[model samples]
Target: MATTEMPNWFVTQFNKRAQHIYQAKGNRLKGTVAGADRIEANEAKWRLVGKGEAKEFQRGQAATPANTGRGIVGAPLKTFQFFDEVHDYDSDRAADPNGAQEKEKIFEQGGMALGRSADREIMNVLNTGAATAGNNFIDLGTTAFDAAAAMTMCQRLQAADVPWEGQVYCPLPSLLWNQLLSAKVVNSSDHVGQDLPFVKSTDTRFWNGVNWFLLSDSFFPVPAANKFDVFLYHKEAVGHAPHTELKTYWTWLNKFTCWEVNMLSKGANVLLQQEGIVRLRAPSNTAITLN
Candidate 1:
């Protein structure tokens, strides 16, 4: 078979494998936020409408029209791509018997690389949202995260009128998760009954009217040594726009005599509402050892 003539089945399988890995490893925040797909051009625009209050109406009174705020928010999509070159010798070697292991390596690596990049970009967007959260940003000083802190986070959102009945989420690092487990209110059955962290034996659980999920330490950016930020927000508070989903392409380079496999995606993560997001600054190095 010619280098350029890859069968349709091969292409389909390659894409399926890469996409599976990408979905499994990339963008832990995928469905947790709002999304706009098939975006036209580089920017995706979302329509924002402000809340309006009702006033007491007198009998036969003329309707009073108030201007409720509304605007267009745009998220700029950026391209993220990863490519690998397979030399003719490597391709020939892969075609040999007992060489099946090498064939899928490139696709796996490409998927993982692109997935990590997507997650990194999402984390950056969270940081940006946190920076601009204004009054919603909370600093816990150097103290560890506890049930009180979690309650405070939930209360802040509730006070701001952000719905908390299955709509709030707190994504934190394992360090903070450990500290939270140390809190008597989280691990003790007396405080939480069967829903206790230790009783549930799960990394993710619903507590204090928020769905808390644990993210790997690598995804979060370290502002300073042993310091990181935890984001608690409503799902509608953030937005993700995808100009293109993960795509893979293969091309034969005549001059280089190599096959270039390229994987890429285009998307943007943006803050949709400041009122619905709360950023908690906490120490990242704190953990509690279980007895």
Candidate 2:
């Protein structure tokens, strides 16, 4: 294992700067999905409880409820590393005493790199989970979303007996959101009666019983030109666990200094009851129109 002889304050600032950039990317999805179970790894094995069956009861008869089991699984905690090397003798810092600022900036960028890495992992689990949701996937065909279509989706969830109390999120692409706007189906308070200039937003809006979260185009998986995967799920439908937030190390040699940062997280997104999540194949991309 490698070690560092850096000062306590310097290490503290490094971690602080790293977490600032790292958390922004992490919280993008972490803050949204609701119920996630967590477990620590020992000897490279971990287990999470899977969803159990629920059945109707008889009024006056003996019954046997189905047995439940944990989803015994072993997924290595993912690690991401970012590093930079600075040559002490052949660098600007070699002559300037004020070069410490540049060094800190380099560390900050390293932190942001780790943050973006975490963002990819978050998206990975979400996309994979939604894709393999089996019967939970609802195909909207080539038709763009409208008020009636959105309401019918809610009814499907209701039929599945998914809890209706908490917020259900619908993560959709920006272009699909425009379809909603053009159809006059979505309008938030900020967009009400404001004469302000048209500024693009990736904000969430309330419509029907679901909160529609507009994500960047890159965040979605667009397998076809006219279709994109969108998920409408309760917090309980997905899970996320971070075994390690961010661990960093710095080392100095005779001529060059080395630095590295890493993070470990486990994904339990697809284990929840499929009824709580509904994947939709919606019309998307640049050519989308109401006609």
Candidate 3:
């Protein structure tokens, strides 16, 4: 039997190709153009009717409808203005000859799905402990990464004060043998399941239509009130505008990855300027942290 070792020329060629893919992913997320506001033109401004005779003589009334000025939407900039610009690559060179050769294939394979893996990374930052639960890590925050914690926390979000019911998920989607496992969950985020854009459809054709590629803006955690019926484009969906502050969020996955985003909730809206602060009411007292 003859052994066939891979050539160095092929490895170098593949590495370059893999790197270019990252740029392509960034371009896709940095949508073609920023969208304009979608609010009604009239509701932005209202004219006051003057009292008694002042109202009757509306032509001369200072606060009448005639004097109403052109009003802009309550800050159109808030709609997912995702302006994240990135051009970083792993500067660390491959040391082992085997790693260098094997990684070329692995990188391509992983990068093909890196978009979704990256999406998983973003959520992992929110629930770091759960991300590593399969590895046998004990707990997350005060609660163990068990069914009880996810269920209790999920219900709390559904309550009146912090009314939110977001779908929880396991660390990885494709790796887990969903066929092998009992197709039911007791009470974990994965038990309830998070809904990807086209996840529910049963068409096994094009990934763009149904397959899960690791696009930057493809996966995200949206609150109930924030969830909409329509599936907007990723750029418009996540608000990743060029040269925006939001694009400069913390990188939880790899410290060097620019794909990470702001982890805190701001004001009553997730958009707008990063308020970076959240108020949580616990059994003992309230806890505030800047995301």
Top candidate (lDDT): 1
Which lDDT value does model 3 have at 155? 39
Global Cα lDDT for candidate 2: 0.58
Looking at candidate 3, what is the lDDT of residue 266? 13
lDDT of 2 by residue, 1-291 (tens): 544565566667666777766565334555555433345452223355554777788898778756666664444456666666655544454224455565566666776566556545656665676644455666777776765666677777777777786457666677777666655545556433221111122366666667666666766766577777777777666554555667776565533344333333233333344567776777764444552
TM-score to native of every candidate shown: 0.84, 0.71, 0.25
Off by over 4 Å in 2: 1-4, 34-38, 42-63, 66-76, 86-108, 131-135, 146-148, 190-202, 257-270, 286-291
Whole-model lDDT for model 3 versus the true structure? Answer: 0.27
lDDT of 1 at 266: 86
Per-residue lDDT tens digits for candidate 1, residues 1-291, read 345644566677778988887776666666567776336677887777888889899999998876678887887789999988877677564334444344478888988788677667767777877653456777877777887888888888888888766767777788887777776657654333233222233366666777676777877767777788888888788888766768988876767776678889988878888788888888876656542
lDDT (0 to 1) per candidate: 0.73, 0.58, 0.27
Could you tell me which 10 consecutive residues in candidate 1 have the lowest summed lDDT? 193-202
- Residue 122, model 2, lDDT: 56
Per-residue lDDT of candidate 3, residues 2-41 (tens digit): 3233345544565466555533432322221123343333
TM-score, ranked from best to worst? 1, 2, 3
- Better structure of 1 and 2 per lDDT: 1
